[model samples]
Target: MCERNHPMKCFLATLLVAICGLFLHPATAAEDPAALLRAADRWRVSDDSLQVETRVQVLGRDGAVEKERLYTVFVQSGHRSLVLMRSPAEAGQRVLMLGDDFWLLMPGSQRPLRITPLQKLLGDASTGDIATLSWAEDYAGTLVGEESCEGQPCWHLQLRATRAGVSYQRIELWLGKARREPLRAELYVQSDKLAKQARFVLDRPEAPTTVAEMVLRDELGTHKETRVRYLSRTPKRVPEAWMNPMFLARNPPLE
Candidate 1:
């Protein structure tokens, strides 16, 4: 009777071990790829008025301090977006965004000048249809593996642009384990050179979810650092009429 019960006990133990193994697996292993893609798409700022205050620091060749400049960014989805310099030279100079067009309003100039596509290509901003939210539309994202960023465990992902006109050819993103928020990102050019890297340190997980603090460092030619801080975010829809280029240049969003 004891020998017969020994085999039954071993079988029960094996079953329990298998059940434990199932629970120990990574949560993302069972996650649907399509669902994850959709979730990433849904992660956007749906606010009527969104503001970001930032301090940009230009670094010397030795990675030491250089100069600091302050700027304010106001974004109203589909309607208008404005970035104004607050301190140092070019104070009060603003970049206005209306619909698909972009214009720069100088501190002294009364008229807003349109930003050419070639000039946009040279800028740090991501190129292509700005309104789209899907990662697949702008980049081809693939799961790299589990990694660590700033001592926290994260999922590493590699995103490459599908089209040639895009700014960066590839981007390595470090996503938070629980929140799925992007913690860090590294941009790379077609020459296999590292262009820029950004680390998001402080995050506000409240409604109209905001990234409170971020440090962006350019690594390619000249080293430049930008620190961004979110001031406020309100859930409000923007008017469609405000998205036109003519309206953007005529009535600047700065005031």
Candidate 2:
């Protein structure tokens, strides 16, 4: 009787240990996602002036090459951002940025066209979602859980637009655990279809803040991909007039 009861006693002890491990594992996993989201949010640059050089590639539906262009962008926070073409023939045409407003100056046209709110949303050659810089204010975020990204452990997050007029309905983000930088993001429309995808790799860490060597790809038939490289950063005061559409068209700073 004693020998038979020994196996039953050992089995009960092992079962209790397994139950405790299951409960503790979830609690441990829960902390990482929230912590990573907070870290990414806290990371920001003090400089208001940002300069970026980008190479854009457009691919056809058959995965064939379409066209390519090189672009240079300069932005002063709350003031203006200027984007200009540097390659592929139309090299000198400029896009003036005053705050949320954007203006395009054609090569032959003397007057700059003030981009309307509706025009901003429309698919324009020079102006698109990349021209907009208000994502921090437009979207709200929540940490979902942990997931692996490219074999590296990462935190998954869900972001939703606070306003109805925003482009994407939902955005899912994967941030690297060790790097504390975003690895991948998927943008979804109201219908829950993936509209766009962005991947951030090659982190150029500047101490407390790290900027992404970014690759933004639009999954639409347009097949546009923008690769942005950080060129310079400066903390300079931005003039308020630069944010106005009328001001942007009238006064474009010459480089």
Candidate 3:
């Protein structure tokens, strides 16, 4: 920095430097990607273990409601989750996820069918979408940048799957600038093909504490829309046995 002898010139230079400093963020204050993800995860999960009642509505290309289903998702610790089909048409069907492995059990069958994370549960939503809610646990990446999103400043992050169990191989997540609440995401499969575009709706738009719903649009041929609404969330931990595929199959339903 060069200094000028003139008092007026010196004052102007100092003022200009101060103005630039306001826009400049220090390296030490850089946001941690993991922490940002964890903060954003809270609006969705709300707890480490929770029982979330979910309603999934699949709409056709014309915006006509085609199929609606309900689910009871028991999110547990250690990357274990059990999702039960609550709709009468899909009753007694259960999907269990334990880390990278997944199994599906039919109402009448005692065997648990092995499944993949990318398998669609309904419309554009995959099984992992309902079961795995924490992006910090599944993906890792750096902060991409900041931009205007949904009429508000947003931080954009590009994340990649840390393990093979997650549904999307890569994700472009946008979060609110202030609270770090997730705004939207672009999900990509292992082949790097864009699978779906998702937008989150908050319960309270102005001051949101929880996510009310997620709207997913298919990028595939169907181009249908799927709305996953969180009907209710209760902080409850299921028994350790619920994580077992054989136990889930034999039990059929949990009381």
lDDT of each structure? 0.56, 0.59, 0.89
Candidate 2 lDDT, tens digit per residue, 94-206?
67655445577766556778663223221212343444344455567776766888788987778887665445778898877666677788978778888778776544434
TM-score of each: 0.62, 0.63, 0.89
How many clashing residue pairs appear in each of the predictions shown? 1, 0, 0
Instruction: Give the poorly placed runs of model 1, Cα more than 4 Å off.
Output: 1-28, 32-49, 59-65, 78-80, 98-101, 107-140, 162-167, 190-192, 203-210, 236-242, 251-253
lDDT, model 2: 0.59
For model 1 the TM-score comes to: 0.62
Give lDDT tens digits, candidate 3, residues 126-245. Answer: 899999999999899678777889899988889989999999999999999889999999999889999999999999977789999999998977888999999999999998888888
Q: Distance from true position, residue 38, model 3, in Å?
A: 0.9
Consecutive 10-residue window with the lowest summed lDDT within model 2: 117-126
Off by over 4 Å in 2: 1-38, 41-46, 59-66, 96-102, 107-129, 132-135, 163-167, 190-192, 204-212, 222-226, 231-241, 251-253
**Residue 137 shift from truth in candidate 3, angstroms:** 0.9
Which candidate leads the pack in TM-score?
3
